[model samples]
Target: MQVLIANHGAYLSGIATTLWLCLYSGVLTLVVGTVIAGFRVSPLTPLRAFGTAWVTVFRNCPLVVVLFFMAFALPVLGLNASYFVFGTVGLALYTSAFVCEAIRSGINSVPAGQAEAARSIGLGFTQTLGLVILPQAVRSIIPPLGSVLIAMIKNSAIAGAFGVGGDLYMTGTRLSSAQGEAVVPVLIGVALGYLVITIPAGLLLGYVERKVAIAR
Candidate 1:
């Protein structure tokens, strides 16, 4: 209680930083993941293999390792950036693999006939995916996408440990240690900060799911 009161400003800053990370990373994840999902489902063998390899590697690799590579290794390779950039990029790339799978699963849930019909009407692969298949596939995509986003929110905490400052995890733990406060309360506050983002997201997902179901 005292800890929170004393550090409310820090906590707020942390939350804002976390949100910034989430916003950028989430956008990147969706964009890259969607493109990769297209690759996974593409008619071209090379595209499919490349997509498969992407998912296999990133999905299997630990998040910390990815962050480590992004944070430490990239600068050595001439890509100098802030810790925030590295963290955001790492989070996005790692999460994108899961997003790709979710989208692929949704795409696969769509019937083959839909693609065939679209092709018969002279739709190219891109047109078929965008105009015909994806609209139908969206219903199945939501639940998994929601789950993945929630997981991503949780995963963002790991970024703090890797020198991404001003995030909730870093703020809470650093303040607690510096002040010699109880770790539990500080952590609880951190958890609540996360809930501030996630609970609303869950509710939003629920609302969307209901609307999608009704539309179906």
Candidate 2:
């Protein structure tokens, strides 16, 4: 353990970077997914089709494939971003598909009568979704949304394989080699690090869900 902290604690720094990657990529995923979800639910046929295509393409693809494309192929194509940047972008794009679906499902969970009520009151589709449907949907989807975020944090490990610096897995591997404590403890530590992020996030989301839950 001390070995991990030695030399300015490179492993700890890598864990921090991993956390940052998850945070940034998670935010990007949320934004992109929300837009795509809007597209999926839009009254416009073209928008729905585009959203369907987006989900089909990204969701079916492997995370590693997306990561490799961003990390290696893009660089070959004259795009020069850091491994961390490209990794985060790839993660966001891939995870955004799942996020979109989860949110859309939440939207569907909303009572259809509510939308009708909004429309009868002279509210537009956007207004109905923004003001009436989505807010309620959010409550129903909190558990799934929490799952998606936890998945995102775990998936961020893929970035480490591609040389994204300060990543948990990469850092763990380095610490194992440098510290000579065998592999199990190092990996356990890595898993614990992930739990540290995920457990609290899940608890917090649960708290929010309860706080916002509609009266029975």
Best by TM-score: 1
Q: Using lDDT as the measure, which candidate wins?
A: 1
**Per-residue alpha-carbon lDDT of candidate 2 for residues 86-195, written as tens digits (9 for 90 to 100):** 98999999999999999999999998999999999999999999899998898777778889988999898887788887788887877778656668767777877778
TM-score to native of every candidate shown: 0.97, 0.90
Poorly placed runs, candidate 1 (over 4 Å) = none
lDDT of each: 0.94, 0.86
Q: Give me candidate 2's TM-score against the actual structure.
A: 0.90
Q: Clash number for model 2?
A: 1
Cα lDDT for residue 73, candidate 2: 95
Q: Which digits, one per residue and each the tens of the lDDT, describe model 1 over residues 85-178?
A: 9999999999999999999999999999999999998999999999999999999999999999999989999987888899999998787788
lDDT of 1: 0.94
